[model samples]
Target: MNKLLSYISLSAIVLLTAGCSDDEPKSEHKGLTGYVIEANYEKKALLVAESDKTAKVGNYDAEWYSLNDDAILHDSKNNTVLLTDIEVGSEVETWSTSRSFESYPSKTDLSKLVVADDVKHPDSPMLQKKAIQAALSHAKSISDTAAILIVQNVTTSKSEWIIQVFNSYSEKSYEFTVNAVTGEVKQIK
Candidate 1:
């Protein structure tokens, strides 16, 4: 009886497979294909849709707002794509096109960005890199990184070089004073 049941199940699976459509189009898209290059959350739309026609990320014509709400779709090479499911740092391969790098943070115009009132620019790139590395290192060690920001360089009367750290990402802005010369972190606010 068991042998008979196994044969019957196998036959059912074979029938199901044979009944499936094999000539259906590979992608769900009917028009415009590209890998999602960039999504602009602020704009409520995609910033760039990467297609073979454009090498660099550029504005391209894609189907937008087809459904009940304003939605975006793209065809990289020739296949339809969705941007939300894509990981921020992962390569994506679609039937049409292939993405070499992962998605990155959006670009901002320096002139428009609201810098902190107390932000101090370092004298040189070397000092800036050093200060940033020190601040990142200190934040990493504290295990409370979500509450930190790399602020301007601070100099005390005792000649101790310090860097200001802010926790603006959290509920309240907390500040930490890091010794720039010695990489010492001191909780200030």
Candidate 2:
């Protein structure tokens, strides 16, 4: 009888071990989802921490990314700002695709950054001031742009301006064009 009992106990132990091991390996092979690693903003882009998966715009989520590398970001006006200072090996939430990763700030908040002038341009304060003065030099031009504040994007082609403005004349938002560069604002009739 004792021998039979020992045999039963051994079988139970083997079964438990086998079950646990099988579950463990399965989990190991599973992929991680929606994981965000911290990244830094640099050179007008985001430098993700540690891994090469620099910050970028994901099709799913949008959030602020911190910079870890010495890399910095520059605005169109040439304003420079420190992107990251996270300690080595430490990572923060970053945006990356399963296949590829990027290290540039998504053009999400560009409108907020746009102003009469950029004070953060890399040029000297005096020079930056001068540039701002020039950017605002076209007072009427700026006002014209402001009137169509719902513009989606601004594209310049040589001496011509191709402005993408949001047309709200209807219930849905539609994109329209204008010539901002020439100081001649044309709208779709």
Candidate 3:
């Protein structure tokens, strides 16, 4: 009986191990969009953080990406550009696929970084100061007391504005999508 149990356990382990093999075909890989926190111009690499509320956006979940020397840089309109043109605070959407392993912060091969320009500052404190004002005006339920959180992950590989409004009195939070280029309110939640 002991021998039989050992055999079954071993078989189970083997099957499980085989199931998790990287040899298995994977689905289509996806791109990651986020702002650059640090750019190692010396190493020709970039430390990109995942863009999301759960992600630190600009600060955390930083992954070191090896940029191909031949990699092309693009402008907001997807025009081919130079490497030196890219800036640290700029947002990027990578075309390369992510690695399979469960590495720290995860890593990916960078094909290119998507750089989109923000034309409107209505939601921005410095550029528009009107961003919050626009958000408040757009959101009927959100009052002056509500706090606004801006996240730029409204779409893929592009930097769009997300106006998140939180009201302590009502104990509710609202999210709104604003066009980074147009400064228009796209959606309200």
Candidate 4:
């Protein structure tokens, strides 16, 4: 009787330990869906706004999310994509760390990013990458040490990119307005 009871207790303990083991598969992490209002390719970060609030209009309340070094990036089809491939105005879902810094635009670390299939402004001729290149090129012509300070899509009746570049040598910032359709860059400031 003692032997049988000891065997039963050992089996129960083993079963309980197995049930609570870390080897169990974890459930998929939940993600937040937002619109990519701004893409800082240089920094590998994005400013995203809640899709429900800023789908078709402004991004006044966007938050900044820096992509982790090991962050998984894929499209809706699950095809792997580079960070530069993500464009502004695209809808994306992100999985991020729990911690975020409190600031004007709260910042967080992103672990995964997926570009949604149903992007609203996919037909735009001038993508954000092209617009940034154009703005940077124009900025370099004026100052060799020019770096992008801000890139914003100012689409109204017509699509436009307002790129702000800072010149370290001159200690001044210049805003360039690039025509999103024609890629014409003009110094607005």
Candidate 5:
């Protein structure tokens, strides 16, 4: 009879412990998916458009998310990448803080950003690489120690890659606008 009671008590304790176990799987929060309309490497921010449906977290609408200092960015293959590796047309999934400011292009603190798909856009690394090479070649004439400051896509009447190179030693700066589609150096100033 004592063994039976002991067995019953042990079973009850086991059941209770198992029910409250911290090892239980928690519900995963799915991140909002969007397309990157613009990526500002200098600001460490991304302007994203909702891929399908409007995404709302709390009272804020998600439009753009600035990368938190600890935010981790990953590519499609799960390889860690920099902001420059994420192109303007790339599809990305982002997890951000619960609260966001109510503004045009509501901003939030990005916790994690993962590239779902990288569509080959004119501003992509492959195209930008050519543009950078051209810009660097021109910058070399001014100063061999010239370094790139900003490389961004600008769309006005025509889409172009704007590369800004600076030579701190000479205090000289050059802005190069390259044809996005053709990867040709269109203008240097």
Candidate 6:
């Protein structure tokens, strides 16, 4: 009877220890810093870019992402912002968990978006798909493994498209900028 009791206790301890394992994956989240290149309150989604000019996360992947209506959005001063308040070119920091980095664009949905009043926004006109079509056409040769790619549009002093590509295996990202009206590929900073 004592041996049986000891065995059961050992089993319980082992199970408890296993449940407390640190090796298990936890919710490791990253904050993505970028600007809101597109905002559609009707759709309750916004495209954010971590790099003002290109997809330059370097060795680290771009952690920035999209924000739906469910996400908590607040201004830099902590004032709450609804989907209708978001504007293009507004500097935004969003929180994201899992992201697909295997393509040129890092596609993700963030939990939160922090917007500041100081972020300048541009009056974006109705989107034209030509630039994105041009970008997607150019990206085919750059990557084939990508399942999701991030796309952002800007219309400030210069109209351009920012395409972010991600590759998880190589940990590589490709970013491109194309003139919106001209559909000409240019060097992205």
Better of 1 and 6 by TM-score: 6
lDDT of 6 by residue, 1-189 (tens): 999999999999999999999878636365666655455666566666554344464432344355643678798888887777766545667776456466434567767778755522233342434444455456555665643334433433356666554434455556667665556765363
What clash count does candidate 1 reach?
9
Backbone collisions counted per model: 9, 23, 4, 0, 0, 12
lDDT of each residue in 1-189, candidate 1, tens digit only: 999999999999998987896855433322223322233444433322223343233233322211213233333343444445332111222222212232222221111111112223343222333444455456546655443232323344232335443333442333455454565656565
For every candidate, C-alpha RMSD to the true structure in Å = 17.9, 14.1, 12.0, 7.8, 11.5, 8.3
Q: In model 5, which range of ten residues has the least summed lDDT?
A: 148-157
Off by over 4 Å in 3: 1-28, 53-61, 97-101, 123-189
- Provide the lDDT at 6 for model 4: 100
Could you give me the TM-score of model 6 versus the true structure?
Answer: 0.45
Off by over 4 Å in 1: 1-105, 108-128, 143-156
Question: What is the lDDT, from 0 to 100, of the residue 159 in candidate 1?
Answer: 27
lDDT of 3 by residue, 111-134 (tens): 667776743444343222234444
Q: lDDT order of candidates, best first?
A: 4, 5, 6, 3, 1, 2
Model 5 CA lDDT for position 3: 100
What value of lDDT does candidate 2 attain over all alpha carbons? 0.30
lDDT for residue 120 in candidate 5, whole number 0-100: 32
On residues 89-135, what C-alpha lDDT tens digit does candidate 5 reach at each position? 56678887546677746677788889865323444444444555566
Q: To one decimal, what is the Cα RMSD in angstroms of model 4 from the true structure? A: 7.8
Cα lDDT computed for each candidate against the true fold: 0.35, 0.30, 0.56, 0.66, 0.61, 0.57
Identify the superior model by lDDT, candidate 1 or candidate 4: 4
Model 4 quality (TM-score): 0.46
Which candidate should be chosen as best, given lDDT against the real structure?
4
lDDT of 1 at 172: 36
- Score candidate 3 by TM-score against the native: 0.44
